[model samples]
Target: MTSPDEDRRTGAVHAVAAYGLWGMLPLYFVTLAPAGSLEILGCRILFSVVVAAILIRWQHGWGRMRTALRDRRVMLTLAAAAALIFVNWLTYITAATSGHVVETSLGYFINPIVTVLLGVVVLRERLRPLQWAAIGVSALAIVVLVVAYGQVPVIALTLAFSFGLYGLLKRQVSGRVDGLSGLAIETILLIPAAGLLIAVVSSWGQLTLLDHGPVHFALLAFSGIATLVPLLFFAGAAKRLPLAHLGLFQYLAPILQLLTGVLILHEPMPATRWIGFAIVWLAVFMLVADVLIVGRRGRA
Candidate 1:
């Protein structure tokens, strides 16, 4: 048997691998361009169903999936989750393809704050003083960004709230739903919509899946695998790591996305935008510090 330290080391590696894949997703989505965001989203959902099926068979999770499907509350919760994730995926794909990858990164950067806010509003949870301060700073950052862009950052807000709400829904059914089973259920629920979307896009002669050559077609077909692998890695990491440790790893993706947007994609980042992001980063630091302090106190 492995020692605790060894398990932690392994979990850290899995966490890095998961977040690294997520961070590089902007690059992957960029390669799928000329394919419309809706089409890509549809195909991703379609393919993910296949991959989830294979995983269900491999892991013998059909029983759990069946149980989850039979429960009215679970199905309702997952249905909402499916819709929220659909929105999040579509928005992220659009942003990545439309030169707003940096803003997308910002959305994820503030997701923890949004999650906390949702807890306060939806769950009636109380926040510590630091959490309140972080939220206030995050709000200020958004105001700064609105001024810098001369409009609300719709893409970022959409991604943040959609994902935050998705997490909330998932949490409701967490006890009954394993990661693979939950994803499989969500994808299954989305299959009809995904099919209709593909049909509509094809009817318009805008479908690029076949026109993009073999490599691109293959990439589109394998979108399901791309979606599933990182999630599996994340599940592995979650099983071995503390929630706080996993929370820290969640920031890796957006940081890489921000770097990719600025360095590799060469998207314009003006001084005002930088100032807004700096404020968000400051809020993030405060949030992290609060988590650490609370964790230490709990341990004490």
Candidate 2:
């Protein structure tokens, strides 16, 4: 067995790797934009399903898969999560392609606050003062974003709510369905819908992959591995790290996204955006602080 220190280090690596891969997702999505949002989303589901199937089979997950599907509630929950995640993927790709990566980043930065609210509302849980403060700050950020953009930050808010609901659904899933098996179920649940979409696209001569060359083909393969590897790492981390610490590391992805949009993509941002980002960041800080403090008190 691994020593405590070794296990901690390993968990940290896995968590960092998982978030880092996610941080680089915009680059992968950018290459596929030529294919259209629907096609990209469909392909992601198709590819993710295939890869997850192979991994699950390799890990002797057939029995587990059968057991999970037998439960109607679990099946329904997974289906709901699949739909939410698909929406999240489509919106994210569209945002990146439209030069709104900065706004997309805002979604993630505010997700934790959203999650806290979800707990209070859906889970009927109570929150401490710090949690309420975080929620208020996050709400302030959205207001600032709307004022700055002269319209709603629709994409960012969509991403946040969809993902928040996805997590909420996942919480009700009976057992840990996170790694290969969990991901497999989510993808497999969507395969039928994705297959229909792909078939329609193919019939219309609009299936972009059929016409792509070596480079595009290579990127598509990379996307599959890239998607799976981080999920596996996250699964590993989830088993080893405290949930509170894991929550803190989740911010890394949005931080990278914001940096990429501003520095690499050269996306424009006005004064109100700065104010919005500031509020969002402050909210996340409070959320993390609350989690850590609660965790420490429990330990004490």
Candidate 3:
């Protein structure tokens, strides 16, 4: 049996890998050339479905898939999540490919604030001072961006809101599907539609992977590993760690994403984005700090 201490470590690691993959996704998605954003989306969905299917078969999750399918409400909730994530992926890929990495970075940076906002609106939870300040600073960043860029940071907002709502929806589903099984169910539902989209793009000679060499196919397949590994790790950690602690691990991804945008991608923040990021991060730091401190005091 896994020890609680081990579980906590695993959870922390899971959160890091999950978010790290998400942050580095721009690298994976943008590296494929000659493919439109939507085309790449289709390929990802298709390939993911194929990979999800094989994993399901290996894990003998067919029975679970059948059960999830019969459950209309649960299926619908996941479907909603799928739609939101699909849009999120597309926008992220487009932004990364289009040299708007910083814009994409902003979306993820503020995602935590978005999650807090959901608790306020949907869960009717009262925000702590740190939470409120986080929101306020995040709001200031948005104001700065709109004032300077003249266009709303729609990509960032879409990513933040959709992912926030997706998490909310996932929280509502009481019966936990194993990570692999959940993905299989979600991918199975999405496969037919993804096929149609791929066909459309292929007809237009727009699908990028078709003419690419073996290396391209190899990279595409890596996406399956990239998609699956962290999710399973998170599921593993969830079994071991308390929600209070596992929850904190999530910030690692966006933080890494922000770092990547600044250091690796070399995307400029300008004065506006720089100020915006500072405020947003300050709020998150305070909120997370409060959580950690309170947690330790409770233990004491």
Candidate 4:
């Protein structure tokens, strides 16, 4: 058996690599510009299915995949999760490519908070005082963004809720479904729709893969790799780390994404948006601190 310390160290390494890759994804999406979001999404599904099939085969995960498919409940749950993830992917790609990188970053930053809220409502999980306070602060931040923008932050909210729900469903079928196998199943479920999309896009003469030359072709194919690698790392980490520790590392992706938006992409951060973001940061700090403090006390 692995020692706890060793497990945690390995988990941290995997988690960081996963989130770091995720954080850098905006740069990757930039390469797909001018490709319609739906088109790109179709390509993602198609190529991801291919990659996942290879992974499942290589890892000898077909047994698990077969088991999951045979189980009606698992299939139903993964189907829902697949739909949610598709929405999340579409929204994220649209946001990143449409100059909403900052909003995309903010969406991920808010996801953990949304997950916590989902746990409260869906799982009947209890929250400590600090957790409640964190949620309240996060709510305040959203209100501020709404008031300042004179509209709701739809991009951020959609990403958060969709992904949060996906996570919730995945939690229900956790050990029953292996990550690579589950991904393969989801992409396989989406492949028909993806094929339909490609045909439609091809008829419209707007398929980037058709006219954008070899570079575009390669990038589109690379989308599968981009999608799968981080997932593998995240799964490796989750298996080894405590939930609290894993939760702590989740912030890395968003923080890097936020910086990438502001510093690399040069997205505008107006004063009002900054204020709202500051409040959100405070909430995240509280949440992280709460987890750490409670974890320490439990250890004691």
Best by lDDT: 1
Tens digits of lDDT, candidate 2, 180-255: 7666888887888888877887887888776788777666656667778898898898888888888888999998
Query: Scored by Cα lDDT, where does model 4 land?
Result: 0.91
TM-score for each candidate, following the candidate numbering: 0.98, 0.95, 0.91, 0.96
The global C-alpha lDDT for each of the candidates, from Candidate 1 onward, is 0.95, 0.83, 0.76, 0.91
lDDT of candidate 4 over 42-69, digit per residue (tens) = 9999999999988888988888888999
What would you estimate as the lDDT of candidate 3? Answer: 0.76
State the displacement of the C-alpha of residue 229, model 1, in Å, after optimal TM-score superposition.
0.6
lDDT of 1: 0.95
1-300 per-residue lDDT for model 3 (tens digits): 878777677777777767677778777776777677777777777777777888778878889878877788888888887887777777887887777777777777777788889999999999877678778877887887787678998888998898888788877774755567666666666777778877898888777674788888777667667777777777766777777777777776776667767787787767866776777677778778868877898899
Error of 3 at 168 (Å): 0.9
RMSD for each model, in Å, please? 0.8, 1.6, 2.1, 1.4
Give per-residue CA lDDT, model 1, range 2-109, as digits (tens): 999999999999999999999999999888878888899999999999999999999988899899889999999999999999999999999999999999999999
Best by TM-score: 1
lDDT for 249 (candidate 4): 86
In model 1, which regions exceed 4 Å deviation?
none
Determine which window of 10 residues in candidate 2 has minimal summed lDDT. 174-183
